[model samples]
Target chain A: MIRRLLLQHQRLWLLTIAVLGALFGLLLLLGALQLYFDFRSVLTGRSDLSQAQYIVVNKEVSTMNTFLGQKGFSTTEIAELKAVKGIRDVGALTGCRFDVNVTMGGGAIEGVPGMYSDFFFEAAPEAFLDVQSDRWRWQEGDSVVPLIVPKDFLRLYNFVYAPSQGLPQVTEEMLMLVPFNIVIKSKNGNVLYKGRLAGFSERINSILAPKNFVDWSNENYGPAVTAANEVKFLPSRIILQCDDASSPELAEFMSEKGYQTNSENLKNSRLSSLLRVIMNVCVGIGGLIIVLALLIFLLYTQLLISRSSYELQTLIRIGYNPKMLTARYMRYYGLIYLGILIVVVAVLWIGKSLFAGFMDEKGFPVPDGVSMPVVLLGVGFMVLFLVVNFFTVWLGLRKLAMPR
Target chain B: MQLNFRNVLPIPLADTPLPPGSLWKSDTSFESQARCLVQAPSGTGKTTIISLLYGLRADYEGQLLFDNQDTRMFSVDQWTEIRKQKLAIVFQDLRLFPQLTALENIQLKNELTKTLNEGRIREMAEQLGIAHKLEAPCGKLSLGQQQRIAIIRALAQPFELILLDEPFSHLDEANIRKAAELIMQSCTANGAGLLLTSLGGNTHFDFTQHLTI
Candidate 1:
């Protein structure tokens, strides 16, 4: 009978049914993707490295370093600490304080700590890497030109706060005028050789220059610059690479090594909390809509079944048992549900390209295998709809069959 | 048709059909207490008397008996079961299942009642001139064809009492005779008692008795 019904309605386009199926399939895919990404986060221990980090201040340059000296991790010790389990890594480099005077258009423009030399070779294990991946990568042909600055630099230097509507290009010339290169005097009041600005870093808090430049400066201007300027010469925070450092034990190990360790767990917990809130809200909305859809399906099926009262009564009169009648109608709706499911799956497959662009725009990471979950959800929903519809139909038919 | 048993009363009903009903009684004894053939107009009380005997209706002013057992021995649900299992009805409207083929309709009745007498059903269908229509859905058949199908469906089940209401109404004179003979033949074959409500003029075979109201 269902086959006959489908045959009769074969002229109707299957596109609408397929579209509904595809929508459900996409939602199913989204749910599976959420689970997959969550598992990846768990496996990779991304949660451990997102919290606060502690750095030891240099005693010579910073008055606060006196206190940090009692708590600092030595350069060599910090390297060893990196190999410890759960210790992600430590970053160490050097920084110099200078008054930067930008000489764009051959005019002086000034900012404090303007021309600090930073070790571009320093490795940022986690936190810095996250920020670095977004900025620019250095290449051979490209002169160390474009700068990627921290958001705080705009406030620190009183730069224009105009929102960039499009991507901004960075060039090498901007680095030349950062420090007002009047005279290079060390803490000892000795004169160092005058140096030219190579390039400015993205930000003033830290600077990035090739190591070769730093080696040249260290070799060319030694004690004179050091004596003229009373600046600290301490290795920056040490960075290290370990086998599996994204573990909680790394924090404990760092503390044991006479260094203050900041665990990333706090940051991870915060992120997880935010993620949970968002997930709950989204799932709650989706669940409510699905329930409503199921209810509507059941009600519609009941109405359809009840309209065929005479047909039911005739069956009863002819002595077709109640169970057999129920089975007959159940089979009919089951076929309808199967058809709906098949159409839904097909639509989702054809619409993947459309969703691809949408997901890319939304910054959602797409995975390779998605169809299994989508098909499972479609089939599950179809069965649920069929069972609910069957019961509703049976109830209506039973009322009609009740001896009156 | 005849008031042979005791405690019986005769009423001359003028061409009225009997509807299902009751008989009255006093405290010390029963007034209408015996078996009797009753004839009435279509609207008078023929159905009422037959229904009372079949225990399809129980409200009454007098007591009823089954083999000297009080009618109170049965409840209304039990009465329905009696109609289902022991008593068969041939409705004036025939009540043929519209969705079922004639064979399925007969087969379903036999299966539900667990009285599978396939040979008899086929024989009766052939005798009623409806053997060819057995596989056809009942609704597509002519009225006379439906009448025979209904009769065959009912007769296939073994019932002690068969209450037929206008079993011959749709039949022509030829089938009228054929249906009456078949009904009587099937009843006799099963050793079942039969009660038929019919128009007075149509029956050609002589009955054990007759009564006209």
Candidate 2:
């Protein structure tokens, strides 16, 4: 009965406009949140292959450096790069100072004919390697050295080199079974050890051996360090583990130092940052719309109370409790807010499902539903709005219902 | 509850010369269930006294007390409780919701108090001869009819005191007699006190006391 009396003077059009505005605002907020969640999951889920968080950086080789034979980084330069913002950890890519030769076939392998090749090998810290294998460890007495070849190198061999040379393509399983001899030759002495394929790396491009193995080999077989030949052992490439590969600070520091890395990785970082900025802007606009909608709703409630002020006063004069009247208005507006939030959540869920379905068709599977945080956020927004508007209504009615 | 007026002079009448028998600026007490007739000429604060006692106005010089408790000290909730269960009034201008039908106006009070059932309310309306007009909006009714609705609304609530300020100004003598009989019966049934104000003429109901305000 109190609701009926108070609602008598309510302008329907104003209520309709307020409800529509609130719906539009909340839907935009929840929709943007849902999209952000989906994009984040997709990015992180495929981060190993596509989003290279570990970037291998090297000083750009120049004619001046070539003439001076000063391509490797100095200790001071490596420390400075380690101190760069956003770089979490830095490890050098150590190159072999000794000669490496791989000899396959002639009883070394079961079926292949005799083949030999000179190969350059590099090793990095285990933390920076994308591939993990128990066989990657090398002890001093172990004669079999495990090697991780780049995935791109195998692709090039199978797709281009082998096809052109009319050679049979080898699968990774087949290659892993092949054990060949690695003959290391240096001025100190010569050593022959068996080598086996450990794994293929998607992140690092270099043919990788274990850091322990490289350190041992360099200490035992390499020449004594001289002023002119010292650069041969210095690290020319460094792998960086960064917190955000897309941080502009990392790119800026790299560019300022005349360093080079995979441009695609930086481009992917820029894309991620761009998505973050767009999401923030969308959320800002959504928040602004919600605030404006709440203001409109408050104004509408005030107008309704003011127009019905006489009736409310009369009711109070006849002994109607002000708190009871305030509760009535709260229940009315609370239900409206709840309905609006439920509709917004439903629409966002359906929209996300449709988008997920579309992405699935494109071979990119996104999660199918509104994320839990967004739903909780929506509920929080509804409660906040209800508290604000209900307080306004309570204040207005209490003032009007006061004795003159 | 007893109403105690101690040298109470409404702010508007602070400078006015008081008649010899006037209750203004005088220590007076009306105990519980004491039916008093407050007769005065026009512009003599008859409505103001009713307003002060009903807590509609606090702009007075002296203290007005309900059972020795200062009325000025009452909070809004306290006043609401007093109005809901202790005191009821028929305002000089019938303060009915114009948009509501006469029965709804009466039921608005009845719903809150729950003192009188619908049958009793309709019976009271029939006795006051406004039964047929109960379905009509109070705004569309005659002043006499609205006055009768206001009276029924006041009697529908439980109260220790019921104030009527010029309640029958628009009613004919015949309707006024019927309203007075109904008012007397409702007061007798509830064992309530009556504070009826008039502009000095023939007044109905034998009162326990009369005061010139």
Candidate 3:
């Protein structure tokens, strides 16, 4: 009887649904925003070390080595740095055992300096390097050596070196066009090789050559490097490619070990943490809105019950327990919650679809399904609404039965 | 149930005109197989007394004991049991759920126990002159006809006591007697006590005892 009679308040119920659905939509939007950005940052490598999962570390050059060059990490120091937590893999930087110069046809170009102008050549483990192309490897019979020049080198040449020398500045494409001869001279022998630029490295700061080329150059012409440059045979810089570049623990360990990394590495760690804090705040606000919506829904329900208090009192006097009457109310409010759940789930599905499509367009990994945390949030929201409404109706009915 | 009232007067009014029975005094115990009239003029809180007896109100002074147990100490569950099994009422306002049909209003009480079948309910409705009006919404019915429906609704449940507060206020004397006959048979067959409150002589049932409050 109470169920049928209370149907007069059609507008009240519609208002309840409208308000709840709007709030629920906002919550889903916030959740989708958080998920999309977090996914984008990780997939595109904006979050951690420019998507390479590797940070370049070395010993900062002291004033004593400033005129010469940076000092190298010894093998013992490299082993100790490998023990740092979160350091997945570490590779050493191999310096040229002998000084080398590049010239076209064994002579300096008209405007471009080549022969007798020394340049550093370094090699690192191919797995840890930024350039992934097979062009970086070489064979013994192969005369052509693949090279990876650092982006900072071109920038320095364009902005600083070319203007002062009154020489024509070359673009990356023009530089890749030149097939040059690398001349290595030592007491053992002189080796000549053909080489071209493979790519540019953002994480590594020096020109890179094939490990085969560097080994051959060192074995043949190593004795030519005088004691003035470097007396040691070990590498000059070390690279540690970590799995999690955003970890502050890695930074603390690096500081403790007197190791140095580039400014961009530290900047990326801060960006990752900032994104995390924003995501957390969004989730917190979404949670708070859900709680407030529940409160409003409770008040709305009690108002309806209060309007029907006289009818409830009549039912109670006729030997109808108040809880029995309120139990009928549970079905009524339960259906409302079910309706809200359907709306939120549908909207969330659509939102996730749209986001997933965007991710595919951006070349990010498309998720197999909507993330588990968002789905769990949707379910938790529904359960909480139903539970709160159930108790609200029960308490409202009991209050109606109380003497006024 | 033995209902005892010790100095059970209602709280005095602030400044409004007080009715003759405002300062009521009553000591009573009646068996289930009896009929009683609580006589009072209008504005005398006769509905208040019914509400207190039904365990709906507890603001009045003094103790209202039922079967030697104070109604004050009764839990909500106890009150529900008492109302379902030991007490029922036809309020002065004839508090029917207006959206339900007359038959539905009556069966809302009967559904708790299924004490009275639909056929028996229709028979009693015919006797009280509301048989033809059973299908109409209670809010659409005449007040006199709704009163007959309220009387039938209260009597449809199993109870040890039935309290009627001015139930016949809108009924003619002939219709009131017809409704009263149905109530008497229903209460006597269930072995329940009958207590009716009225402003004047609208009922003529043989009283087991009369209390002037």
Estimated TM-score for each candidate = 0.46, 0.72, 0.64
**Better candidate by TM-score, 1 or 2:** 2
lDDT (tens digit, per residue) of candidate 1 on A1-404: 32232123222234334335434643544453444344334534432334423332221235665565422345566557656654455565543333222223233343222243422322222333323322244333333333333335444433333234332333334433343322333344533223334433331234343333343434444443454343344454554443333334553455454443233433344444555566666566655555666765665555555555555554454444445667776776676667766655565554554554566577653443334654676677767777776778667766654433
| Candidate 1 Cα misplacement greater than 4 A, ranges | A1-289, A338-387, B1-87, B97-122, B132-137, B198-213
On lDDT, who's better, 1 or 3? 3
| Cα lDDT computed for each candidate against the true fold | 0.51, 0.85, 0.74
Docking quality tier of model 3: acceptable
Best by TM-score: 2
Better of 2 and 3 by TM-score: 2
Residue A214, model 1: lDDT of: 42
Clashing residue pairs, backbone N/CA/C < 3 A, model 3:
A72-A236
Best model number under DockQ:
2
TM-score of 2: 0.72
Q: What is the TM-score of chain A in candidate 2?
A: 0.74
**Ranking 1 against 3 by DockQ, winner:** 3
Tens digit per residue, CA lDDT, model 3, A28-75 = 545645474556455435633334367778776678778865567766
Model 3 misplaced regions, further than 4 Å: A13-26, A33-292, B13-27
